[model samples]
Target: MDRRNIQVGDYMAVTSKLPNLVSSTTAIYNNTNCSEIMKTGNPKVEIFLITLLTCVFIFGTIFNSLAVWVFCFKMKKWTETRVFMMSLLFSDCCLLFTLPFRIYTTQHPWPLGDSWCNALLSVYFMNTYMGIAVITLISMDRYVAIKFPIKARTLRSPKKAALACGIIWLVYISIRLYLALGAKWRNGESCFRKDTVMPLKRALYFTVFGSCLPMVILIFCSTQIILTLKKKEKTSMNEEKDIKKSISIVKTNLAIFLFCFLPFSTGNIVRFVIESIGSDCSLIKLINDIYYAAQGLSDLNCCLDSICYYFVAKEFWEKASLFPRFKKQLIKDQTQESSI
Candidate 1:
């Protein structure tokens, strides 16, 4: 009877643990499957990304270099606009600096040491957010200058703009340093390729603050500026042409900003969803492709930013000697308020 009791107790214990064992096994299987799917390369997607990045690198380098020359050497007067343009240019250059390394890593494993890989990635992400923050600042500055010209006289200045940019740089640098110190590098890890798992908190924070907040601020400021400009146009007939030009420039800037950054933000959200739910191989592959394409699109921002420079800065058009036929007209249309 005692022996029977012992056997029954053992059977009950084993039965109680069965569900946990099965769950752990299933979890392992899912993780392994996801990793395998991510490791498998898609040649078409790879080729597309490589081609896109190469073009971006070439164009971005030339455009941003010209911007640097105009902003630094050609532009004589220091104003809030120049300060912001310089900040934006700095961020673009940083991103461009990482492109060659990124292009190389796309097809080949990172021959550089793990430290170099981490540093490059840190610079890339750091400047990406930095660029977004500076663009937001530019929009806010424009809105204030246009919406309330009197207050802008005191509120907006080159020194203040420089201070604001300094704060942005400091904040991003600190964040990157903290992340680098805390990050754990796995052996044989490839640059720009990591595990399928996304940290819930970090991803949420980045999506909300890094992308969503900037986008919202940009849209709001742009809408207010446009409406204000339209009202001004109605009140002042003599300035109608300038107002129309201003509206066109604002719309173009906003559209370019959205087009470049939207894909990467969307990919981030989708990746988070796929990770939260147990991995579907199809979804994994799709997300991987999205990521590749999105990265190329995001890098394209460095090139498109030149458009903003041309329209926003009077010196850019005047000193760069671009579009000579329209230079006089542009100089007239780009009044203090219109340029801002």
Candidate 2:
């Protein structure tokens, strides 16, 4: 009878431990599965991204600073172009302010805590979309100026441009502020490394409104402006050279806009789709690599915005040369030309 009692006690003890043992085993399996699924790191891609961002930081800073100086001090009159350019420059500067942190986080774990991370990310994304919005505005402004020259006088003015920019800033800032405040970060999670998938609805909204809509506006406005200029070129023989130059600038601007932004937007969509469909781990990793590279490319837009400032602005060269250094160079060039 004592032996039977002992055997029954042992069985009960073992049965009590079985649930814990099974749970422990399941936990181990899950950990192993996650380790296998998640990428450790990709050294090559990291190096490339670091290099690209570094170059963008350097060039974007110099160009944007120069542009700000030119627009603020050198250019005396406030025009529609000046207003839009200044707004775009401000957006670029905002993005540039966060680039150092972005580069740092790319290589090392974020040490700035969650609040700082969210703030920087908010500025980063807000300015990125702001840049897009201002560019679209510029294109639309150009189209209006070209398509309806008579109406453009009433339609395009510095005050009106300022109002438009203000609206964009208000909208984007409000949305970003909402998002930044509402974001919930997990414990031990580093910046830009959230484990939770973005909600499908939010992703769809951003992909459509943030990227696709602006791109479509850019295309439509650019096409209309180019066609209008071409028609003018046909009718006006004396200004053929100037019209051709304008067309070339328009094409180059459109090309730069697409080149810098398209890959990143496409990658976002592709990554979202892959994640939604439960793609393989390797495929997700590949998409991540591509997305990172595309993000690097997108950073180049700040540097390239200088191209638009120089070519698209009517008074850029004139105002730029007003600086003592450029003025001296201009004099020297004219002297050499006359001597030749």
Candidate 3:
């Protein structure tokens, strides 16, 4: 496009334009069309969201930050997994840092103004796509390690992983921010809603490419890994143990992301589809409740990330300094007591 057109596009992207004082025009319409759609999200769900987000903030911060430290400071040689892990750590922490803002929004209006609200909401969107891409990469990398060890030795490297990670982050933000910046931001509306101007197709394109595609690829890689392990089951005892461990890891990773993604994505997409196709008040209200609950569950991925990303380290707690020392000291005390 021409510079003039580009300038216009950029201007439209960040413009503040919303309908009123409550989240988005769509939310207003929901309440208008649906019966008490705004009240569909029960009090317990709100309370649960607040509690869950707070826990994610505490644990995700501790674990993701610790992983970043270990990958950057403690490790001398950067492996492919370390590079990917570090990227995932950064992404997790990025979203985790914004949890306090998100938590407040669940209970109160956006007290921080449009800029903070938009920026924080954008961060959450960026996290979902960037994280899904990175997690898929990690899963494929592990599959390569076990299935084709020699090939992995040649193809898998820190530099390549870092390069791939950079691309994922860049592409995701470029796409997501196009939606965020170009979005109509009103004073009283929440930042997460779709504007009338922003077509539903845009959201679908993002979901298909960013979320669905990555998920499909991840499932494929996980399946291949599991099959290969079973095929080679008669390998040495250590190899058998590793195979079981790898299978467990894949299962856990799949469960965490899929569990989070399925609920929110289903509800969110269905709600939009219903809105686009034909307005059904009861359906909209029901889906709204589902969306809110699932959205809260999806946020738990910030915590689940720590389990799949950080604990996968084979070196374990050697450099963690957070776990082993406590265990070792406790064991020492137990030995002393027994001897006495």
Candidate 4:
């Protein structure tokens, strides 16, 4: 029979294989606290989670697919914009790739082995961190482009974008590989790493690398872009164009940083702090659940990125038709110019 079909009582195989510490915890929870707290199952919560995740998965898959298609087939050259956009799509899709497992696991108990369980955890964290890194760079790219156009032209190139993306992924994956191999669920419960000390340490690393560093870079770049635009307000004729450019950069950074990432990271900071302060295990579990829920919210940003693209890049929006349509428009415009 499938693992999903198995009852709580039939959880023998998983429990039997677990280490004694885990087994003891499981038995204690099952006998004493499980009924009082867990209410036998979380089907309602699981249903809601599935519904939310399904929407996220479908939207993320579609938006990223379109972005990749446009980048590969429609776009002419590997410009800096295209390079950053391509990198974003790739990173976004990595999270989308794991959605099926996440969605399934919400309703069903973990179906896979220990290794697969750890792998899922690692992939989710790595992809999320990677995506944040790329978005940060994209904001910086925009800041340079608008604030210092000539300097931007020299610094912003597809090769550099690709190299930066490669480095981000490599560093993220390297730091997280220990999670995949060393991390394990307690009592076969399919959680993160078993060692208690590592959670606080990992959380500190996460705060610095994934959250703090990116936020600093993003804020500095965005602030510069905003200030430079304000300084150029003396040019009354081009004021609208300049404002739009400034707003584009600011909005992109604001959306990803505020709406997508900040909540979860903040919660994580609290979680780590609580762990460091030696909070009760039950409170830690509650906070962790909140963190995961916040993470679900963050994942939706990948799908919503098309909205950012639309608002930020009006040129792309205006000219985004088939090649034949563009060719026809070009010829018509040329003919009109000749007649005039």
The candidate that achieves the highest TM-score relative to the unseen native structure: 1
Please write out the lDDT profile of model 1 over residues 1-340, one tens digit for every residue.
9999999999999999999999999988877776776766678877887898899999999999898888888889998889999999999999999999888877887798978988988999888889999999999999999999999899999999999999989988998899889975433556776555543556557767988899999999999999998776355665676788888888999999899888888887777777777567677678867877887898999999998887888667778777789878877655444445
* Each model's lDDT: 0.83, 0.79, 0.70, 0.68
**lDDT score, candidate 4, position 336:** 15
Determine the C-alpha RMSD for candidate 1 after optimal superposition of all C-alphas. 2.6
Please list all clashing residue pairs in model 3, or write none if there are none. 13-181, 13-182, 17-185, 23-190
Candidate 4 achieves a global lDDT of 0.68
What is model 2's C-alpha RMSD? 6.3
Clashing pairs in 4: none
Candidate 2 vs candidate 3: the TM-score winner is 2
lDDT of 2 by residue, 1-340 (tens): 9999999999999999999999999867754564445435578987998899999999999999889888888889888888999999999999999888878877687787888888887888788878988999998988888888889889988999999999999998998788877765433545654343332455557767988899999999989888887776354553665677777788998999999989988988888888787666677777777887988898899999998987767566666775576765654322110000
lDDT (Cα) of model 1: 0.83
Across 1-340, the per-residue lDDT of candidate 3 in tens digits comes to 6999999987776564433434677776765645334433457777988888888788877777677777788777777767887888788888887888778767565566777777877788788778888888988887777678779778878898999999888887787678767874443444453323222676567677877888898899888878887787465775566566667777888989899887766766777787676566666556665677787787788788767643466543455556664856543322110000
Report backbone clashes per prediction: 0, 0, 4, 0
Candidate No. with top lDDT: 1
Error of 4 at 265 (Å): 0.5
Off by over 4 Å in 1: 185-188, 198-200, 233-238, 322-339
RMSD of each: 2.6, 6.3, 12.2, 11.9
